[model samples]
Each structure stands twice: as C-alpha cells, then as structure tokens.
Target: MPTRAHGLRSRYRSLVVAAVAALMAVLLSPAGAQGAGSGGARTPLSEPVYSYSGAVRESVWVDTGLDGDGDGRDDRVAADIIRPREPARQGRKIPVIMDASPYYSCCGRGNESQLKTYDSDGRPVGFPLHYDNYFVPRGYAFVAVDLAGTNRSDGCVDVGGRSDVQSAKAVIDWLNGRARAYTTRTGGTRATAGWSNGRTGMIGKSWDGTIANGVAATGVRGLRTIVPISAISSWYDYYFAQGAPLYDGGPDWLSGYVDSPEALGRCAAVQQRLADGAPRTGDWTPLWTGRDYVKDARKVRASVFAVHGMQDLNVRTKHLGQWWDALAEQGVERKIWLSQTGHVDPFDFRRAEWADTLHRWFDHYLLGYDNGIDREPMADIERHPGQWSTDRVWPPRTTRTTALHPGSGTAPGVGALSLRPARPGAAETFTDDPAQSETEWAADLDRTTTAKAGFRTGRLTADLRLSGSSTVTVTATPTTSTAHLSAVLVDLGPDTIRDYGASGEGITTLTDRSCWGASTPGDSACYRDTAARTAAVDRTVISRGWADLGTYASPGKGRPLTPGRPVTLTLDLAATDHVVPAGHRLALIVAGTDRDLIDPPGSTPTLTLDLSRTTARLPLVGGTGAFVRATAGSTAADAVSMAPGARGVTPPHPAPRVPGDGRP
Candidate 1:
C-alpha cells in the first residue's frame, strides 16, 4: 500500500522516539544509583506538609574502614533510615537528621526507654525517640545508626576512641557519596544514599550526643550543626575530675555493657587495650588525648546548639563550661540552655517549648530558612524550677574573679571569710576522715569538728550571684606523702529547690501522656508528662571540687610529698549559677574524701593550712566593691542556724546505677 521510500522513513522515526523515552525513565527513577534526581528542589514551609506514619524505611551498613576488633576485615556500622515517602515518589531529595549511638540496642532512650524494633523484612520498624515521627513529615530523613560494636554492627566499641568517632563519620561520608555502603552485612550488594540532599544535622543526649561532638571535631564537610545534650567534651573528664579518679575500669565496663554478640566474639584485644591505657592512676595518658574533643575545637566548622543540666553530676558541668569557652575562643556559632535539673533532657523538662525551638533550629540550619534564632540571646538559664531567664551570653560581662581570704572564728576549725588578707603566720589544721562526706560536714556547720575546716562570709543585705567555676588555692603541710581534698561552696539558708537526688533526678513522670507528631500502631509519638520534684533545704551546696594532693600542678604526673613539707595545690570546682539571698551567708568547707562521690584515698592524711596563704577565687557577678556593698553593714554575728530546714537535707549525689543508663 506504500512506496519504498515512505515505508523506510516511518520505521526510522519510530526507532528515534523509543530511544528518547528510555533515556528519560533512567534519569528520573527515584531509586536510581545516582542521588538527588535532576528535578526542581522543594522549598520548605514553616509547618509540616508531608506524611510521617507512611514514611519509607530502609537499612544499610556503612564501612568504617577499621578492624577495631581484629576481625581481619573492615568494620561495618548499621544505619536504619526513615524518610518521607512523598519525596521519593516525586523523585526529590530531603535533608538528614542523624543520631549515632551505642544505646540503640542496649539501654534504650527517652523517658519511655524505647529501643529499636525490626519488621519481618529486617527494616527498622519502631525507631527510638521522637525525631523520626516529628521531622519526617517536615521533609527530613532520620537515620538512627547503631554505633560500632553495638547492635547489628561488626566491630568493637573503642569507648570514645578512634573507632567510635569514625564509625559515625563514615555514615556522613556515605551520604555525601564519598564512602561505601552495603545492603547487607555480608557486603556482596552495594547500596547508595539516593534519597539524601547531602546536608546533615546531628542530635542526641548523653553518650549519643558525645559522638556528635567527636564527629564535628573532624571538620567533616556535610555536617551543618550539632545538638549535644548533657554530653562529654573530654572522656578523661568523665573518669577523672582534674587528677582524681571518679571510678576505676570506666571504659571497659561501658564497652561490655553495650556489646552485641558479634562484638563479644572478636573484642578481646580491644578490651585489653582499654585496660592497659587507663591504669587506675589519676595522671593523664595518651589515651585521654585521643578522647579529648576540647583540644580539637579549632577543627570544628559546624555551629553548636548545646544543652546541659546545671547540676548534672554524671557528665558534670565542667564539660560544658570548658567546651563552651573553647568553642567561643574559635568563634564557633553557638547557643546554650542551662537547666536546674540533673542529667535530664529538655524534652522532659520543657516539652512543647523544646520541640518548637528544635524544629525552628533544624529549619534554619538544614533547610536554609531565615529564622531569627541566630539574632536572639545566646543563652537561656533556669534561675529556679519553672523559671527561665535569657542573657546575651553566659557569665555576664560584669563578672570578675574576686579573691577572699580566711580568718579565724570564735570556734575551733571555723573561720570568717573577708576581702582582706589574714595575718602572715595565721594557720588552720584538720585531720582527714575517710568515712566523712559533704552531707556530714554540712550538717555540723555550727558545731566544732576535726573532719573539716569551715569558712563563711557575713549575711548579705542584697542578692549576690556567683556565675561560673571557682578555684581554691591552699598552702598546706600534709602528715602523709599524699592526700585527698573536697571543697564545697554553700548558701547557708532555708530555701525550696529541685530535688535532683530523687529517683527521677529532678522530675516526676505523670500518668497522662502528650503527643508530639504523627503516630502509627507500632510506634507512637506520645510520651508521659513530667513535673518538678521540690524539697525544702536549710543549706544548698552551691559548687564542689575534688583534688589529689599529688597531682596539683599537672594533670599528667603526680608530685609525692615529704610528710611535713609545705605544698600548694589548687582545686578546680564545678561550674554553677546561683544567688545568695539577702538573709543567707556564703560559706566554704574543705574536708577529706567525699564518701560516695569519689573513690577514697588509700590512707587518711592530716593536713595543716596557713590561713594567710589560703584563698578562694570566686566568679562573682561584679567586683569586690559590689560584693561589699551587697553585704554592707552585715557581719559574722548575723550567721544563720546550721540545723536542717522544715524538710530534711536532700540526699547525697546520686550514683549512676540504672542498668541501661549508658553512663561513661
């Protein structure tokens, strides 16, 4: 029916049309090997606009390139991902929110203690914490990674050493197409981060948060920001306070607590390394340098949103204090929140406010939104339970270090602290008692005791605020070659405060529940409410410090004493923000081993101090003149009673005894 030339032309045109259709399909497939299709980028709104419960879920194993357990193969870290399905269906990419932690399979997370659960196909079903539920619908992907040596990963936990930090970094590298990932641990099939936009932000609490700090210090390219809550800046600070061992066998103990079956089979050599590195000696070691993130602050390019409890005895405030100062020195963009609680997360302290603020923070950094969070004050400090105040920066601009000298009082071992120096030859002495504690020393403040030496300033006419860490310098002659000293600053008066030592560590969980985001039958966004637990106390320990007499000058080595020879040592106290009311006196007590707080010295040593050479440097809101004016006309004669208040004294510092607590 057609001529020869016309038939040839029609078939040729059909072949050309078919080729164009095939090329387009390959370029636009959402699950293609190349990431972030050539589609238009999605602009983010201030509110959620996608599905969370119906999010796409998958699993991958990222290679860390380290045989930490001597398995003769590169280690692989397991990463479980949840992302909005709408983006994948539309062939668009989304930003990532990652949390790399050893606790995903061990101790659990949040107030409800939720762990990761798996579906029949081995994909992650119940992702712990509320990040997945809240952010996925906001066009973000949440990746919950099981750190090396824990859960389904293949390696040994190095306990904040090279392996722990790098494993997390590997996942970040994979998202940027710089590292290799596999669909299974066996590693025959390759997997890719095709859903990622290559921008990432990390968020976590405690040890989980600690990994965020370590990885950021590596100056990784994809990391935009980090939120580390109650985390450690230096692993050395966690086990040793200054040069005193808080506990022995710290690293190995934690590693064993979080190990998986795969790790247990090959981590023998790794365990031995930890023991040989930390020898129960208080002196600094090379192992500590490898774990210290503060020293690497210069390498950090990511902005920080730090949160910490003012009274957190576990990770302690010094970690945040020193890290904050170091970050500031490098001019890293930062924001902070100091709570009145102890080792508690803000989600439990201020739920709705924390969620909204965190949401906006992620939006500003990851989504490139023009939120005014960066223009606001840098710090939010809790003045008291349920009362929060903002400041341009911490330790107000007027803060100055004031030196106070001690002079003898009417009673033995009791003294009055004043602005002027004491007589040159004046001295005070006390014997160390191994069985004594700060609680025992505080209770007998008015009476005479050989267990400790007490000093106090006159009652105040107006409020006096102390803003940061204080240092105590004592020139003493020890009766033994080595000794231990505990110094505590106190506000001697009656006041109601959060009971941090209680079971909940400053909060009581309520029966009622509140939801944050979308929920499914297996995974719910609902969490129990919490309330502050208060206690009326006669005196509050404002700040405390511990020191081993031998390691006074250097954190690396110890200086042995010649029994009766005079030696000078400085004690570094914990950081705090507190106000001494008009009716209260500011007091200091120097004593022996703090019973349950730290390990006791091998033998009790008696020490004699020359009051003339002993002084304390307090970080007061203003200089000496302001402090003198606040206590204008007041004298030692106005001291308040040392007895307990309407409610008895609060309990001692809480021990990290919870089985799955994930403490270092």
Candidate 2:
C-alpha cells in the first residue's frame, strides 16, 4: 500500500482528470453545450409531446362584479378546465385557451348542435366541441366557460351586455390571478389557478365568439389573442340596421332564447332593462354604445384572428366588416378568413386545413414558437365553395369606388343603370306601404304599381367583382315627415344561391354523423353533417341596406325631412366578395320598408327620387378599368328610357325575405 499522502494526491489527480474529460465532452457536443448554456435551444412546437388522455379535468366559479340575479351576491361564471396532467404533476405552468359562451347547455355550438357533458360528480368528463380534445393534447389548457345564467353558473342572462362580457373577463382575470373565484357558488372551498401561466387566448363562434370580442374589448391582461368567428361587434347592429329594428322583441327575446333552466322569469329584471332600453325608433342609445366593440377598439390589446361567413345572415357580415375596419384603424395585428358558408365554423368547412392552421397559430402565440404565420398573408378569402385565395390585405388595397348612375328604361317601374350620370330633373317616384315584403315588391319587375323602383345595368362585357361595401346616395323627398329607405344590390343571374335569409339560416339537419376527435359517453366528439341551403332563382339579391330616413344624419336621433324637399341620403350596403359573371346585369332596387327585416312606419308616404343626383358607388376590385374603358366610348345619348310599369323585364322569383339577408 502507498503512503497516505501519496494516495490522497493520486485520488485528487484522478478527480481532476474525470472533470476535464466531462468538460471536454460537453464542449464537443453542440446540443449538450446548447442545453447547458443560458440561452437554450427551443423545443420544436410542431411536436405533440403532451398526452390528451392524461389531462386533468376540473371546474371553478369565477366572480363577475355584479349581482345579475339579484341574489345579493356577485354573479359567478362556471369554468370547466382541461389541462395536461404532466404540467400539474411536475409543478409546471401552462397557458390557457378559453371559450366563453352562453350556448354550453342550450342551442349547442356549430351546425351539429353540440352540448357540454359532465360526469356524476358534476366535473366535466367530456367538453363540448373539438376545442378541448384537440388543444389539450397540444400542451394548451382549454377552459370552456358557461356564461353567467347559462349552464350551472349563477346570474341572470344579460345577453351581450355588461354581465355577459364581465363573465368572460372575470375568468380571464382569475387565470391571471387578478380576480376571485371559488370551488362552489356560495360557500365552497377557495380555488386558485396556480397551474396557469397567466397567458391566455379566447376563441369561439356566434355568441361564443361575440363574448371573445367583448372580453377583448376590455383590454384585460393575460389575454394575448382572440379568434372570433361570425361574432357580433355591436348589439345594435345585430338587431338593427342604421336605426331600423331588424328583428322583433329586440334583446329580450334573444336573452330568453339562450337562457336555460326553463324559467326565464328568474331574470325578469334583466330582461325588462333590455326591453325598456331598446328604442323602437332604432335610435342609438347608451345601451347600444356600451355594447359596441368597434367603438372601443382602441382598448383591445390582444391580436385578432377574425373569421366570418360572407353569407351569414344570423349575425350578418357587417359585424365582421366594421369590426375588421376598426381593428385595422387601430393598427391591431390581425388575420382574417372570409368564407362562403353561412354561419359555419372553419372546422366544418375545411377540416384538416383549419386544424393545421389553428394548431400553428396556437404554437406561435401561446407556445412562443417563432412560426412565420405573422409574416404570411393577412387575409384568406373563399372565392367560391371549397376554393380559397390569399391576399396581402383584405378588401384588396387596389380597390376603387366606381359610381354607377340610374335612369328610367322603356318599361314601367323599370329603369336603366349606367356608368354616366342622368340628366337634371330626371326622377322616379314610389309610395311606401308597411304591409309589403321585399319579395312581394320585387316579384313583378315590369309592374308599374309596385312600391319599389328598380334600375339595372346592361349586360357586363367582363366579370365584375365587388369586394367591399357599396354605397347608395339617394336624393329623395318624403311626402310625410318620416320614411324608411331600403337599398338592395341584386345579381340578375339565374343561378343557385345560398338562401341564408330563410329560417335555420340555410342549415339543413342531416342524419349522417362525422367524428372529429375522441368521444366520451357524455360528450361525443361526433357531429352531424350539413349542406348549404340553396335556391334557384331568376335574380339573387347580393346585399341590402336600410335607413330610418329621420336618423340619416345621426344614428342617435332623427331629423325629419320637409315634404317635397329633396334630401340626400348616403347609405352603405353590406360588404361582399362576389363575382358578377359576364352577361349578368347588376340591379339596384330601392323600396320603402323591408317588412322582413324591420318594423314598418305607421304612416304611408310618397317618396320621389331625383335620378340625376342619385348614384350607386360600387367597390369594384379589378373591373373598374374595363368599365371605364367600356363607358368612355359611349355618351349620355346612349341612356335608355322606359315607361313606368312596362312589361319588358321579368320579375324575380319568390325567395326568402329577411331584412339585410342578401347573398354575398
């Protein structure tokens, strides 16, 4: 044996050798060096490392700052949470993807009508829709919240008002440790979202999506992004169009429709406020201003991913159009998907593509992955059914407003639309009748005694694509103190169009079922298939606009017109992305009172239009050059003249009549 000192020196030398060897090995390996460094190599976001089957499911009641139910306690929003079990087991925090909705227990979501399913202990074993199943496995915590008064939450249903919005905002706050929540409604154990990372994203469709928009408008922290599909930007816009009530019963009826427990009388106070607040004259009030998200766009800090069906009549396209415009104005980072289907989710339309895109979006925003999604095109528009195109910007930056003039044709109640202005003093007249529906007024194109005036352009030499909102400038005088004006843009083509204006909003219930993700006994991941409701007709109404003539200058109040005094009314039709094919004529139909969309005036009024001053400005995407070149070669002498109510043009076929229910 060696001496004790010699043995110690030998052991120290051995230790030094092993340490040097280990350092060298680490320095030689790039991956090992990266792992050891302060700035570590990032894990690939595309990998599916999280297990969906091993997710932990739980519930919490978030406190909204109101006693909506008048129970002398704050309203609580019920949230069903599903997250990766590994995160909580390993003491790791995960970001949240939330869907706050009122349809969790009623009416369901999407075309298939999906409802939430719970286990025996009231804990959610299976969440409704595919959001929880698909995202939970992708390392995201999915929270499906039951809006106040819906599901098992405690509150009166306020529709899209303060209670509805605050219900969602409170959930987001609780996730970020800013709000109070409990394990039960009144006196249960306290709960904390300690497993959350305080970063969240909100998404949903229809009313669910509207909640996303409403919550984002509050600029709450922890909400990083939002995806609102077919959402409502303004409650007034949903039920009214330019100061004209679009639906009856206003907010009260809608509040009752979505509220559950079958006892709407429980929320009678809330419903009464909605009814009492809504002015029948369609004038804007504090109630509407409080619910208008577009007006509060500046408060939105979260990035937006907006989707809308061009033919969605239930929520209408204006909700997306105006909201998108406001977001752009605010310089909010945004992406858009405009589809051809009516009120349909992207998953139902383009399943695989939607899944991939949404996955990548979550990876980039929530996972902090450096994906190139933000660098891609800002807009994806469905040109036709099952066909999509990308653009650098929405509404095409190259779009120009082209004006088309109106003139009388050889037929009675028939007129001509031209690219040039009509002569001075040229005018047309129509009488307002409250009982007539738009379809009835448009039924006889050549009839002279109808309550509407029709003007059509000659057959197009080339295809005309309208990509944005069209404006109708009417110079008319009302015989009475007030009158309602309805402007319609018609596609005079004999083709099948999506009849979203009809009941059910063009959704056809089918017996066929399609599975999306994993299913449970309580919540099946399967959904029924649906087809577009269509109609074959001689003419298809592309878009329409309504205005309470008295509220022309301001939406809040009316300015009555003097009898026989011409006043210019500039109204904007719904935005569209449609191709008016060659040989099809575009028509402008101006009528009084669209009974299908709004409550009619109480009196009959004769309205006279000054055709010389009246014009329709269309947002032509690419065919403006062709139109200018085509019209440049012609003169004013080419204007067509027709008698009133002549029998030259065929009437449009009877179709669904709903206010602002025009095909995109």
Candidate 3:
C-alpha cells in the first residue's frame, strides 16, 4: 500500500521554494522580477500520488545473491515486478520503464514507496514524483533495480560500464518472463528511463548520465531515446578538468558506491583498490581512448536529448561543449538544453518547461507520439538577462570574439592608457622575480600580489560572448630557456578579480583564460644550454599480487635559452563561453603568473611586458572589420576601474583588493 507521508511532502515543498528563490536571485534578478510570481510558473515539488493499496496482482523478487566474479564475496540482489494499478480491458502490451540506481534498495520496499506513497489517513500521496508516475495509469510497468555492489546486489562496484550493461540485461530478461504471467496492459512491451545513477536510460544526470552515454555506445536494441541531464561525456574529463584532477567531488562519489557503514569504514580499503583500479592508474593516458564517448558518437544510434546547466560550476559547462562537438561530428540528430542553475537543482521555477521538454521527448520516442519535439531547435540556448534563444546547431552563429590588449606597466591598480601601435620605436622590459611570488590572471599561488610591466584593455558596454577555442598570441624575449607567460582576461567592472586553478577552467570569475602552449611547439633549435639527469628504479611484489613498479624518472630540465631573439608565444586558452558585457571593460593583464591563480615552479621568473608591438584580434559582431580597435589611455582609465554595484558583471566573492605593487 502506498502511504503518502505528509511530513516529507511538506518539507520537500519548502525545499522547492528555497531552490527557486536562490536561483532567481542569481539568474532572474536583472529582469526586475525578483519574487516568486515573476518568473514562469514553478513546477510542483512532488509528483502525482499513486495508490498501491489494492492487491499488487503480481510481485516477486529474483535472487542476485551469488558473486558472479567468484572472488569469494557473496552478494545480495533482487528486483520486484509491480502490475499497473489500472489495466486496459483489452490487454495491451505496454512499455516498461526500468529505473536503475546506485542507491540501496530496502529489499524492494524503498523502491516501491518512491513512486507510490500514502498519507497517515491512508490516502495516497506522491512525493518527489516524476514522469514515471503517469506510466502506470497509462498501462505501463516500472522495474527499479539495485545496481551491482549496491543494496542487495552482487559484485564490486563498476561505475557504469560492463557491470551496468550486464545488470540491465539480467533485469530485462527477468521482467520479460514475469510480464507474460500478468493479465495487465503493461504485461507486454518494454523500454527504460533511469534517474540519477540508474543504468536503464544509459544517460541522464550524474551516474545515470554517463552510463546512458556508455550504453548507447553499445547500440543496445529496444534502447531508444536517452535524455541525459547534465551528464558527463567522458569520465576522465568529468573527474579531471583537463590534466588536473578533481579532488573534492571524487571522494564524495566513492563514499556512495560502497553504501554500507562497514564498507564506508573500509574507506582506505576502497581507496587503495580504486587507486589500483582503472581511473587513477590511467593518468590521461592513451588507454582512455577506449572509453572516449566522443570517438564513438557515430556508433550511438539512439536519439538523445542532453540537458546541461549553463552555470554549473561543479559539473562544469565544458561537458556540454564537448558533447556538442562530438554529436556535431557524428552528424547525429540530437537535442540540448542549457539550464540556468548549478548541478541537479530542483525542478521548481522551470518545472513546466522541463516537464514539457521531457514529456515531449519520451512521448515521441517511447510512446511513438508525434509531439513535435523534433520540430524544435537542435540546440536550446540561454544568454544573459532572460534571453533564451534556440538554433539548428550548437555554438550559435553569433558567438563572436573580441581582443583585449596587454600593455606595459599593467598592474591591477594602475589604470590603462589609450594604446596605439607604436612606430616600432621602443621595447619595454622588466625583471621577472620568480622568488618575488607572482599571481596569474586568476590566483594567489605566488605570494606577490602583482608583477611589474603588465598591460590591460579598457571597457565596453556590449555583452561579449566568445565560444570555442581561443588563443593568446604574444611576442616575448624570455631570459630563461623555459619561461612561463600568463594572459588573463580581468573583469574590470567593479572588481579587480582573478579566477584560476584547473577547476577554474569552467568557472566564470572576474577573469580567466590563461594557458601555456609550447612557445613554438618545439623550438628546441633556439636553446643553447642543456642538462640531463636520470633515476634508478627498484620493485618488490607483495603476497596479495600487488607490486609497486618502483620509481620512474623525475621531471628533467629542458635546455636553457640565451638572451637574444624575441619569440612569439602562442598560448591556447581552454575552450570556454563567457560574455564580458559592454559597460564592463575586458582587461588582458600579462605577468609571470597570477599568484592567486596558478602554481608555477619556484624557479620561474616574474617578467615585464612589452606592449608596444603586441596585437590582438577580437571577433566583433555587427561591427566593421576583423577586430575591434584597441582603446587605451585616459579614456580606458576612466572606463576600466573597479566600482561598486557595477552592472553586467558578476560581483567578485570576498571582494578584491588592489595589488600592492609600485608599478601600478
């Protein structure tokens, strides 16, 4: 019987309100409507209540208790079949929705109560309900499964790869056999929809999302449309932003996989095991090429609707771009939505829209309804200030770029002067003190607050949106063979801010866009001095078949450079989509590193910038020419200074202080 817990429903209702309020404050504030009634109708927090008070007609659990791997670990697992509360008079073979999740199953009790609940008064009530609720009444059955290594399931945790695939096959086989004995409408046809980490859909948010992408790669029959919300295209890319690994989220994730308290107490055990597992050992190696979803995008025949949050710092918006690129390359028919909040936000403010989107997708694919989901734009877009646009393809045609120049003596505090290309007259120079501690465009890694001889650009009012790959082309004469130069795009709105670090790649802070590509790919011929060193390795094996492969070579030093010719450094900024609006002047500050942003070696130098010969090519939209004219000097100084309550720019958190360097 479904028992609607009024207490839980009330609490969840409050949560829905709170989530909307927070999202509105962040996203809908400038629209002049800051309250509940202003935005679109908020979706109800809970799903429609369903009753299971009458006879279940059919219910059974199959044993998944034995360890298939024969690793001496027995496991417990099972799935329950729930007949539709209402069946068609004329038997109809209805579709099935298989909800696969990593969450522990309370021996089928918890899973059943998720969709159908009752109040203390014995009245049915649904809380945190979803699309699956409408299925039963429409002659459909749902199978909720406990993935391997989860509650009552066997085998070690496989994060949605082979383990999930095998599990899905097992559950599907079981469901098909049981449906034959039932006289209800759902006793015939089948399909799947996974929520969260459920493996059924092979795609959706979090675990479910990744698995969907993986499952789709297999081209499983009967597997149709996959609606992955905020899913990761590549596990490596998800866990590690670029080369730097994501430390915080990964640990939280491991805890859930081994749900038991005792299993959790074995944290060190699991940690060690996983370290020896595939993820940690890979280290961005070529081996990951096997799991690269983008490479197999063409093989993914299932229709897909990938939804992502534009401001999702945790998941990072880069995944959306990566997926978009892959789908484009495959020429696959796909749908995408760029939501407004962070990862997995509640379905309140944009509830109707989200529900409508999902309903249409499932209806068209699963139920075979022609709901025009195909008629919509391929790419669902969102710009600033409630501007929601759509396009036949991603990275809309209007994604334009604008260049901001870095000039001499450009410190956080110093105002930029009107810059014009010099007649090749003089070259600016300054000593780079590696020990002095410097900051990148985004961090405080170095102790020094600012460096000497940097440059910046003035302000503008038009919102600047740059997508895809961006490069920083610079001409520099390094004093050392291995020199590191950083270029930062500072939001000179009202905050002198810097957002850096590997995690900082997808985040839109006051400023970002700093990278180091080989100055000339491999300009080894220019180097004059060189040195080499090597280390010996020793290995020993443990009784448990574990062996440490001893030490590998320590990082070696590259050839040093002689102090003569100036070379151009082409730095590849990670592909990002950010808009610096009109009123907010985009300043490009150049320095050794943003002490607050990057952690360079203790031996690199803090050098000066020569802006006289520097050039920038900014993509201007609806404007004439290939670039926007560089504006510096007094006009720039007045435009790009820090002020309070500045419009168009997200205010800096914790506030920013002027760097205590004399150059400014």
In order, the Cα lDDT scores of the candidates are 0.82, 0.75, 0.42
lDDT tens digits, residue span 464-496, model 2: 778878889998988998788899887665555
Model 3, position 418, has a per-residue lDDT of 31
**Cα lDDT of model 3 overall?**
0.42
Which candidate has the highest lDDT of all? 1
Residues 1-664 of candidate 1 have per-residue lDDT tens digits of 4787788888888888787776445333322212221255432334456677778888899999998888689999999999887777777877899999998887898878889999888888899889988888777899998989999998999889999998889999999999999999889899998889888999999988899999999999999999999999999888877666774347877787788877877887888888788767777889989999999999998899999887777888888888888898999999999888888889999888899889878877887765567877888888778888888877788889999888776555458888878899887778888677787887677766888888887788889989877999988888997788888888888877778877677889999999888898878989999998877788888788888888766757777767998888888888888888888998888887887577777667888888899899999998787789777887755658544534434544545434276453
Q: Which regions of candidate 1 deviate over 4 angstroms? A: 1-45, 410-413, 641-644, 647-659, 662-664
- In terms of lDDT, model 2 sits at 0.75
By TM-score, the best candidate is 1
TM-scores for every candidate against the unseen true structure: 0.91, 0.85, 0.58
Worst 10 residues of 3 by lDDT: 539-548
On TM-score, who's better, 2 or 3? 2
lDDT (Cα, 0-100) at 658 in candidate 1:
46
- What would you estimate as the lDDT of candidate 1? 0.82
- How do these models rank on lDDT, best leading? 1, 2, 3
lDDT of 1 at 150: 95
